[model samples]
Target: MHLANAPSARRFTGKSNRQARTLAATLVMLLGLSQLAPSVHAQEGLAGSVKRGGVIRYGHFQEPACLFGGWVQQWYLQRQYSDNLVARNEDGKILPWLAESWTISDDKKVYTFEIKPNVKFTDGSALDAQAIADNINGWLSNDPDLRNPTAAPYLGESFESARAIAPLRLEVKLKVPFQPLLNVFAQSSQGILSPSALKRGLAVNCENPVGSGPFIVDKWHHGREVTFRRNPEYNSAPATARHQGPAYVDGISWKFLPDQTVRYGSLIAGETDAIYDIPAVAWKDANFRFPVLRHLTGDPPLRLALYTARPPFDDVLVRRAFAYSTDRKAAVDTSFLGSLPSRATVR
Candidate 1:
């Protein structure tokens, strides 16, 4: 689809900041979809019976930039070792995770969060408000040599500073009243850390990472795979968490499989429990057992671009004709091998 913003085609209209923000949020929700498939326990007809002890073998196409620091574009991988202050439910509602509760000021420029107590990082350091403040300060720092390069984009102009007002309370001040700041807090990029590790600096965390997440980084075999062991002491699952108490699996090993064919082969051969971004051919293959797939439409995909300044595309009538002539369903079936959700369910 052509997203033309030319003066003649589509002019910019002034909107109240709040209204604009609401519109942007609505668009974001309509664009994204998330899905996860979990392994079923052997026990039947049990409500709270969670069988634990096996390591979940997972396959990914790419390796994360840093074990603890850098952000991965994909959601299925980044969350293994990081725990954000908050989490988002299936309906896009924000819920508390590391922080037990939070309060916003009348002007909405300030946020005070009461962090959950007794939480410890993988390195056995307490996860207090001080550690969270340090993370924010590091992200929003102006020093070229002391800032987290991956976190700069999210900090932007909205974030002012995050400080610890109490041992378990954090106050975050923003430049403007941004409603999406809550959502941003729930993202993997805002994962909390151990204060001691932050003192050790970012480099050590990259290799020997520490977080208040469900898993701990046990080993990293460079380009091959990363091994994680479940945190036995973890009991602070979010309200929206799928399972109660500790993780169902004993641990998870994320294997890097750049080749789709090899990944699919591993899955079929019982070498791996699950895989990500399987090729279209393998996705449609009937031979695969217990296969699962999820499609993400978190942004308006670029299909065909038409320059409005050009002769044919400049005419509104020509554009309308092209849009009417295009079969979107057929395009979805052909281009994505019917793996993509229909436009109506894109949200």
Candidate 2:
């Protein structure tokens, strides 16, 4: 992938284009030298020769996204292959990613983001402010009259205009001063993509997607599996745990196995490293010893959607009574094996 030099109006304050190129060249030379050495530590591994390589196979309990599923699938694919301008951590805090920093106008109707420099798409396309603006335009094009909408209603009018301030800075004008506009920007649906990827078409390239994330799509077997390899050009890394330099694993393979029984069985047999939607009965297996991570499925406190504008939900008293009488904890215990706790309202 190639990245053009940042325009004068861009806000990135790091090394200039020439300086970055020099550093990259120097690093390449050092890497080549290290490869010739017998004991040199590669960045791929934490210890030893550091020439780590392995494929992480995961089991899925439902049909792959191409066959069925909607935004959730799109969200997962984006997370796997792309980085967002902002990221919402497990604690619900939004942090910067593709955007080095940002600001809001006094009226909060305008938000301007300073994009990072030297970012590139897997397809060898430059990822610039104009590309981001174009992606936003794409979302805006389909936001209205969407048959199946995401959780956020503000997205319907998320932007008035997305303008390129420079090659690496974009200014977005919102129709109204929405308080949670930044959160909407951080949503996976709003993840940035190269102009070429959008032009090539989303559905045609859904399985073999491309982005500027830590990993790149290596191969995709439709309805069977998808594989990803570490991105050698990933510059902006998250301040998270374990991962440093390059990705810890060499590659990852996502296997599509719709049968929950087969998925769990494969996990138990050590054929797969992870499996989604564990069965309730399998939780009690004392011998099973793998980390299980769970999170609030829906946006903040609400898991179930309530159509307050509709008939039964239109009555305030009835809604409140339903919220009160419903034993959320009991339902969670019986349904999700006590993995999730119920919250009172949608946050």
Candidate 3:
């Protein structure tokens, strides 16, 4: 796929996509998706005098069982109510969030993070080193209710334990070198939750998982939607964040519309301010109306899965021919997320 403003064609993979999506969601909440608080028509009509403190109704495709979980959709809600140990930039570089600074051992197994002081969860619990340690251990635990499936592969067998060396220092011990440790910590699934709220158990916590983010999960109306209110005392934004205070919007009504057409339609009809994913068919059209925020997830440009054990794929020459024949630019142009204009048929 070809990304960026006038870029080269390259292979693409969906890996680390959750991070980009989380960033996109964060962008919506933070920047208010470029004055995201107001209605589309209101912002357009009012111009410079942008309205403030209006609840944004966002449309999405899927709804997870709870707020925080392994599924990509779950990560969406998690990002709203949670803050990670660290943050990542547009260029895929790691930045400080809850952790102000860190040092790595020569072996790279132990990561000592300096937790930012005075950070607190919406539930009025302090987010200290011990709090982060509890979150880390929760991710590595055997309990399904707490274990972060998104972080499981990165932690693996080598992840030993997370301990509080001091009130503001956290020591994460690993059995082997895991270079992607910091990057993985930035994922939404790894977002730090309040230990106090977690103690209430999954049944209650899933609907109202506490975090130190910009917003708080107010209530979930079953299969229909989930509502979020701005965290009034919020102050712990990542180093990369532009707005360090509460979210500009009053609250968010995140609606679940599984059908792609219906979801995009909601955005068009002025019922929703934003949607999870822009549909491929509506990509070209949606850009004309809304300020479509495209996130260039810095992974491989493309990744092709070949069942090489069978038939044509089994032959190396056939695989080589297939690679060369792929219309990379056209592939990018035709997809919803791609930068170029759609012209060619999807492969």
- Please rank every candidate by TM-score, starting with the best: 3, 1, 2
lDDT of 2 at 32: 16
| Structural similarity to truth (TM-score) of each candidate | 0.77, 0.70, 0.78
Q: Write the number of the candidate with greater TM-score, choosing between 2 and 3.
A: 3
Would you give me the overall lDDT of model 1?
0.61
Q: Which stretches of candidate 3 lie over 4 Å from their true place?
A: 1-51, 299-347
- RMSD, each candidate, Å? 10.7, 13.3, 6.9
- Screening candidate 3 with a backbone cut-off below 3 angstroms (N, C-alpha, C), the clashing residue pairs are 11-301, 11-302, 12-300, 12-301, 12-302, 12-303, 32-36
Q: Clashing residue pairs, candidate 1?
A: none
Candidate 2 local distance difference test against the native: 0.55
Write model 3 residue lDDT over 1-347, tens digit each, in one string: 22222322321111022211122332344322221221233333323333357676777777898888877778778888888898877567888889999999999999999999988998888999999999889988888778888788778678998999999999999999988999888887788999999999999888788888777888999999999888887778887665566666678788889997888777666666667666667665766655555543433334336777888779888777776787755656655355433333212
Model 1, residue 201: distance off in Å is 3.7
* Model 2 quality (TM-score): 0.70
Put down candidate 2 lDDT per residue, 276-301, tens digits, no spaces: 65666665451235433332333323
Q: Which ten residues in a row have the lowest lDDT in candidate 1?
A: 5-14
Sorting all predicted structures by lDDT, with the top scorer first, yields 3, 1, 2
Clashes of each: 0, 1, 7
Candidate 1 residue runs with Cα over 4 Å from true position: 1-49, 74-76, 143-151, 286-288, 291-299, 302-325, 342-347
